[model samples]
Target chain A: MVESVEGHRLKLLEYEAKEYFRRHGIPTPQGRMVTTPREARDYTAELGKPVVIKVQLPVGGRGKAGGVRFADTPEEAAEAADALLGMRIKGLTVEKLYVEEKLSIVNEIYLGVTVDRRNKAYVVLASSEGGMDIEEVAAKTPERIVRHLVDPINGLRSYHANLVAKRLGYGGRKMLQFAAVIESLCELALEMDAELTEINPLAEVGDGFTAADARLNVDNNALFRHRELEERLLESYRGELTEREMEAKSQGLTYVELDGNIGIIGNGAGLTMATLDTVMLQGGRAANFLDLGGGATPERIGEAAKFVLGDERTRALFVNVLGGITRCDHAAEGIVAARRELGVEKPIVVRMMGTNEEEGRKILNEAGVETLGSMEEAAKLAVKLAEAS
Target chain B: MTRFIDKDTRVLVQGITGSQGAFHTRLMREYGTRVVAGTVPGRGGQTIEGLPVYDTVVEAKESHGVDASIIFVPAPYALDAALESVEEGIDPVVVITEGMPVRDSVELMARARLSGTTVVGPNTPGLIKAGECKMGIMPAQVFKKGEVGVISRSGTLFYEIAAHITRVGLGQSTCVGLGGDPVVGLDYVNVLRWFEEDPETEAVALIGEIGGDAEERAAAFIGDGGFTKPVAAYVAGRAAVPGKRMGHAGAIIQGSSGTAESKMNALRDAGVDVGELPGQVAESLKELL
Candidate 1:
């Protein structure tokens, strides 16, 4: 059975990251982190000429998102700052603005070290060509991207860094500088228990290296040994992240916010995922994917149901579980308890098979929650209910 | 007649002072496991639920001759405990802890292969030999001594198997959770091989979930060897297709290998009797018996 405990939050901000890279001798552009629009405008004016006023959101792609803008004139810079300071990038509202003198760069490169989702190993990627958008870089000039999969046991070696730099078509001194920065990046990644650290346009400026756009993600599970990372993740929750989400995360739950009418619940990861896909397949979007875990209590189930419905987007709920290590009877009782406590006016479609399923189904039917026999049927019912509601 | 565990299996609890370690250790001892010792640095020489504690696996091994270790340590420390157990030569290590970092699990699991040590779980529930011995987190009351052997990747689902087995008078030889992590020590093929060799394990109840190619591989092994003993398989997450990341760092299925469909198809191809109902395990056993 798939289980839910909360998963870790991805924590790292641009200002903190820039400061970190700067200290490590990786050149960052002349910039200021300002919370106030006045500070943002003033910094742009002081920087003079060509400047990039970017929203300091935790998520990626501020440039394409219009969260990032450039202005040649002072008034235009001020206007851009005002527009982006309050804007949202990928659902995260901008509370701070980073106004920086856009560096004069001859070359732009993408250097990143991220834990492979499959192997959980640190993988580094580098590519030459700065200033262009990363997506365009990925799509059109994909051959420019060079990759190195570092064995966690062996770690990132200097020779490996040199290979990536060389493959990016960088020659001699620039290649050496890039290799040196890669080593520094590796140190930062390993020391921080980082899941990812991407420096798009790690520029080869006049005699130095600077990361123009930085994206770093630290491994959440490894945060116990890293109290520093815990502080980094805490920034996103500065009243920005919802309490429900934070609670779900802290408890090791992998909660994704979706715009759907049905709240999907299941035990195993596969079933929970299927429920979401099936909801969409039947022309219904899912509000959330909540796995109450294999051993979730009736009380936990009720709380989860309440949490899912709390989004105000949910009109119906779907619970799919095939009990194995967890008894189906426990799941049934949990659903019953949830229904009684939450007074679920929302329609529920349950497909439970395995381990005391009959007893579990009996509890659900008696509780008046509609129970479906198949996952496909449950998804269809949930979609229909959501549409009707 | 459990294959992997019985009353004689000398058990050691890693992170014996933690909440889970404390909780399940008591239950395991109460269920009649020979929990000879525990490990929790400073908590050594102290007692929890009346079991002796040691500072390290070495101390536990020297003093108690702990052959198997039931890990209650947290995820970060799981690899350390697993490695230490192997270093101290603890056989059949049962790691009940979840959230193990994949890198460490890979190293430890790899080490397990090299050292000839058996590792049960990084996020598994553990193993139990019906009434004779309870090595994992399954409820004790559900078990009864008999021939059917239950094996799963999840701990909670196995409880359902146990209850059904209990109801049908076909007690479990032992239920093992290989854990749901992507890089685990044991897989379906490994466990099934053990079950095949065990005289006490007659009809086997193989419980699997929707990820990993462990089942496909297991089916191949079974097909090649032709396990004459009746094998009952129940693959959960029937409709599960979304990429569910591993909760247990060890549990992951890459490429096209470990999907639920592939595992199910593998079992079907192997000519193993698969059950749709939990109680159908008993029916399978009845036909074989």
Candidate 2:
């Protein structure tokens, strides 16, 4: 039940992932993004062939949700677009459709490069089995999947790529083509600082291969280095990141909106998440998850408080500060200040400890705000307050 | 008997002129850590808190014989700072900076592995030997000298649980934060092995959040008799939804992997006592001891 939804990475949608693929010399189906049925029909008519209309959402199971449809005629493409445009899948509205020229696929193969956290390296996974979940393939028939751990220093070398291609049962010129796609994917992953770069079902169409589906998850910390790509991919689509989430990002805070009434704020990521979990265990739901990071000053704490309190759904606020690098007094000041400034009679419960704990408690107590000693106790009281409110 | 850091460990601070670097350096020194030197790139030949600031880790190592280096450089420059220390053959290069690119962390870990240098974190509160030395940004007040070796993925949760342990008249021997990022230098297995070797550590308390298979791996290690010490654990993120990054880059339940339930079950199956809450962690460890 750990329900925080803080997406730090830039997860590019299907169309955007393919754009990177085309840029990296990997073959993909020619596609156009359309928001309306007219645009979909126009794009399909221009292609002069059957097209696949796929709704652009960050979530999976789009096919199961009927977000994917194939149309031979432009009229049918328009109808498919009309059905999908305003529909919701996995809580995300289908604002756009990706129409691609249907390709004659002979075979499907999986190729990807992702960060192996345990190994602390980029692992390239290739399999003859594709067009299905790779996890399923790995779990059910792992022997079919060939995994190669790329040396972080050496990167994905030519030998590594060739070895993976050979394992996937490709040889001669076909192996070379497969190897080339693997090289490009590795290159793209490195250049973008991507956590994951995947091509599912690398369709074999007569002469060569084409990426039928692609996913690129750029590292959040490397977003500064990829500002241009970030603006192009993230800012344009604004895929999973909401308005408040974006605003919180700008404020140097990690915030995720949940459907509960208690706004939860803590200094560190794990503690904040634990705060949310504790609230849940106490039979209360957290309205949001916010980590104030380390060494939060009074100003930053106030800013975070204001941001969390800005939500109309946040009926009560729970501030849990263990105060390692973060001073408990600063957190207390922020809570008192935000409550005073907001002037909304929302109940606030704080549990402050560690550095300057007594001072912090005094500040909150002087402000007539309730303060608890234990995180579980504070969470219980906050939940009780939220339910009462 | 102490692990990672002791009172005699010669420490150096990178990015010493920065606010966080300078602040933590003083605190580390105040807690009896021998913070010998600092590196501030262009701010070489300057002095911060009575310690000479060298332009490079090579110079600092030559001058101060620095054993460990704590990095406080910003995310963009963390890779360069960490590499400099690793190349200089500094053991246990502690990276306190958060949000370091996973690519950078991988490269750092790779280089560290080749050099036989132990890298603590790219996003961590660092490690401390209770009542002896402190190398991270954690407040020195919460910990006291005792026999429990504490390891955690989160900085504040480490403190919260450590304080609880201390409150119950138990203290930590060496508390190490494995960092809260997906790709980190040290994992639970590495720390568990070290704690197993530490003579003073009677029991272990592990604070794990939902992310990665680090805990599961630790459980496997303990189950395999790689570590025979009594262990108690508390895993957070019981309420985490799949596909959502829970604050920490590493603290996400991706698909069916990295779940709290899975981690807890693994530890419980390994004869380790698993606690439901953070407070229960110390209590469970107390019972195990």
Candidate 3:
């Protein structure tokens, strides 16, 4: 799994994640993200029962943070939405609320499927004790959790799902129903290219099961194959991007904003991270994390340089590149072009090596940009320059 | 003797017609790796850089006696390409493609495990046996032939440390890039074990980043005392923020689990000399040696 330019998984909202469950034939609480109190009231009135108003923020632990509330009446639902709409949880503002009919939960079970990297297989985790904290349950009552590794070639078979359900103390019709949920979850995970798909608290209501909450993280790398999913993700993330971030996204560059004086740019993620660490170690804080990626052209590098140095907070720039697939000359040319066009006054410390190093250094020298040979020296110079400015 | 690839390795380049594949194939060939053939479906009988091209791994193996396959397929097609090599019973398959889906990589790993085929990466620079043979995108100029074995999870960091080792007049037996992805083939433990068994490798330079417990597990394996080779490590991402992925899919601080501090402490506890910076690795290795 390679990180997208944005870094980390694109976490789907509760409503969004549940939609996958619903599409996969798993029973999920009927819900939709409502922006206003009127929409919440309208949805609650249609349900005609006690509903849950959950603040839709892309973070976990909303239940304990007062982001979730039960509304018995339409008016209560509207009030819950009003109270939650403008609230913030985990630094993310709650602009929407997922309104769903509340299920009378007799039992809560947890089921999750993810790649077991060390074991090199797909691990399906099931626990009878759920809804609260699965980690706590695994730690306190380890036997309550049943772990099974699915064979990659054969995938999660019906028998395997039945075994998981049987281990969780389900038998007869209930066992069959629970097994279906497991099978559906597996299918959803496989079809969606999901890195992690979890149904925490698969509530037992009367005779059937309802997915109370779900967490689905699709692989960003595979998003190219899922155009509809990508469009949906973009629709969900419409208002989340800053103006600069959106521009970087348009250019297909990974740029993460930070609060510092030095702008950091590198070719690879690992190298960029190491540059950040070196800058910090030398008493310089990084203003952003910008990766040019492999096989970046001179034009792309120049665009990245302009984008990063455009930030007003940046007093100095550190361009650390160890070119393998990416040629150092291309990166150098880009930096030179950015400096000329943007008329950047900040001190730009560049450290370049490997793959056309001599030509890259010559280009930088001709552009009046002194390049350093070592990462440590370059980082120190950048920090000193930032402090001087 | 190197554990994976050597001069005799008859390499097959998957996706040989692609830009990256064509470029690195020539570099590997120039570096003395026996790149016997290439595979590009529907392009069978075509030749790239004088190397014969086949439509499938089976066809390539039949005609050229392929021992290893370096896959340069795109992200979406990487799993299928790697699996094809595994099915063909390629001894060691190196995938240079990055950004493969984690689920797909997990499946590839599982299949490779069952077949006992050693897979290298879905997002890596591959590996090299110094001056003898190379199967990756690493700059050959930075590497020298000698006894120090190198294994890393980061691409650029690996090059940086290897350059330092070369500057200090040291060389490597086999330098393996375990990949920057969260799910990868040939992790730290796998390469470390091989380094321990290889008599030519007297010391090892283990480079890791924040995130994952591979380094911690490697430390545990070393702490068992069965590994006699002295190991020097450098864990990057010390300045990384919590929960932010520092480029690599696996390089992130997930709560307090995968921190640079924690990894360094673990390595230190296991009697591995840990460096604070990439350049300091040479000093640490000098002390260990």
Candidate 4:
């Protein structure tokens, strides 16, 4: 899950989205979340049939990562579960497994609803092709993808859904069923404030459609209106977040860990990113990205500084501040506080300007931290110092 | 000569009784904007900083001919504030509230489009015409009156670039922040169109970051000769790793799209000067002018 505009974006795992799908009257295969291999075997025996064990991680292309396995018996279910329980896919460990009864799928179709940022509207995308990455499909076979923009006020109407269904080659009773599913998914997306709700491979079982795979990305800013949903998914969302991410989330900071040696801290997302880019342009890699949002107090800055430096991979620290709402003197004081607190183990370079620049430079100059006026110059110095260290 | 706000433009402040609303309203007033009146839900007949406060946008609009509105209402109630202003035919509504649900923004944008009202941001620092009018939360000290028009996606970065431009003896005609959310009102295309029409704007400075194809679309617009002015652009996030969001909600690379290299190449292809750093944008613009 990524930090969104105002809060942390929560992407519900397949099992979690299926839980929501069942609650919203969308047909889905019966499934249970199991943590251990014994539980997976027990669930398979209870179902009295073949099952598919899927590792739960908030990432795409799980099947390509060998995270999905099929088992025909209870013993095979346990073996598959054992193989997947501790497996790591896309830097996230498989802490839990979802076991569901296998379906005899005759055909597959793709259906999804999401906000189209460019159009500034809600859009419904459907295709006859399924179980493939939608982006890949859109790029290779754009003609196969059918799009319908929903009216923001009136929402997804029956006629619109019917038109998309017809375009996807559905007709008669199956068309109606498919149209109803579209309407239901649209309603669900709207009600839940989902950024995206997708059902890839809406598997055809005889006459009806079952959601073979589910994806739901809820808007974190809208969580206030959804207390029940937040309560239900908060623990799982916490499990998905890394330790540093949880710390950043609690402290109202935006932090993303990366593989590098230099610790980077800056004000605003754009400046922080630009600082990271500048650092790289100077031949230095950043260990993490940290942004002190608007009105950042000195204490918050110090806390973020300490957190970034706490990483064992970070050999040097670079604090870049273009103070607008953020005060440069405050930023400088925070850097000083951090150095005093951390006992001066790492090389530090500071590029401070705007809003109390003179006072900020004075503070940093007195603290014996290397300070520079130009961002390029500071980045170069940071790269050299990090290399030397 | 400015495209959005000017000294004669009568502005209204929504959620004027709130702390952020009240504070920025004072700053706007001090910056010489004609902040005529304000609106608060139940603060009718009240006065903040000697400005009259109304109970609703309708009351404020009826009382004063509000040309534009700057909203400081919190996220949950910002949608209502914006809708009220749009329904009243406020030409440009600047939403400074962060944490707003994008769904609410989409709904508001639909109505604003029908009303022909230009909405600035749902999470924005706002816009300013140097030495003339100010809207939103950007620091007013760095801006100096000049002929260059600036459009940006980030706040502090805008200030950084603007300060650099000012230091280089080239000021600005107008500077607009298009907001930092995934969905925002008035992207590079809209502002570039306005800048092309504005007589005072001789050149343009565009500060963009990773995310969306807004920069690419702007490049296409310029490449197709939709905009004729010389544009200098600096796109952030060149070193951003794929799949990791770089602070902003929209500043992320999915698969191979929305990369800084892609945006820069597009701008360069359009015959625009694409800078390697923020300060280089000002240097390129100075040379172009």
User: For each candidate, what TM-score against the reference?
Assistant: 0.74, 0.94, 0.93, 0.95
Ranking by lDDT: 4, 2, 3, 1
Candidate with better DockQ, 2 vs 4: 2
Q: Write the residue-wise lDDT of candidate 3 on A170-239 in tens digits.
A: 9999999999999999888888877778889889999799999988877777888777777666444434
The reply for model 4, stretches above 4 Å from the true place, is A1-8, A36-48, A71-95, A231-242, B1-3
- Cα displacement (angstroms), candidate 2, residue A329, comes to 1.6
User: How does each model score on lDDT?
Assistant: 0.71, 0.87, 0.85, 0.87
Interface RMSD list for the candidates: 6.7, 3.1, 3.2, 3.0
Task: State candidate 2's DockQ.
Answer: 0.60
After superposing candidate 2 on the true structure, give the runs of residues whose Cα lies further than 4 Å from its correct spot: A1-7, A34-48, A71-96, A232-247, B1-3
DockQ of each: 0.15, 0.60, 0.54, 0.59
RMSD each, Å: 6.3, 2.9, 2.9, 2.7
For TM-score, candidate 2 versus 4, the one ahead is 4
For model 1, residues B1-289, the per-residue Cα lDDT tens digits are 2347888888898888887788778878888998888899787789888878888889888887877888888787788888889877778888887777555665676677677788887777788887777788876776788888777876645665666677776787767877776556777777787887888888788877665466777788888974667888776654333433433332333334455667778898898877654446667777777
- The top-ranked prediction according to DockQ is 2
Query: What stretches of model 3 exceed 4 Å from their correct place?
Result: A1-8, A32-38, A82-95, A133-144, A166-173, A235-247
**Could you give candidate 4's per-residue lDDT for residues A114-173 as a string of tens digits?**
888788888898988889877788878889889998898778889999999999888999
Candidate 2 residue-wise lDDT, A1-389, digit = tens: 11111245677889989988999999898899999999999999999999999998887778999999999999999999999999988667889899999989999998888888888888888888888778788778888888888898878888888889998888998889999999999999888888878898899888989999988888878988987775654453254667777788677788877778999999898888889989999999999889898888898999899988889999899999997778889999988888888887888999988889899999999999898889989999999999999
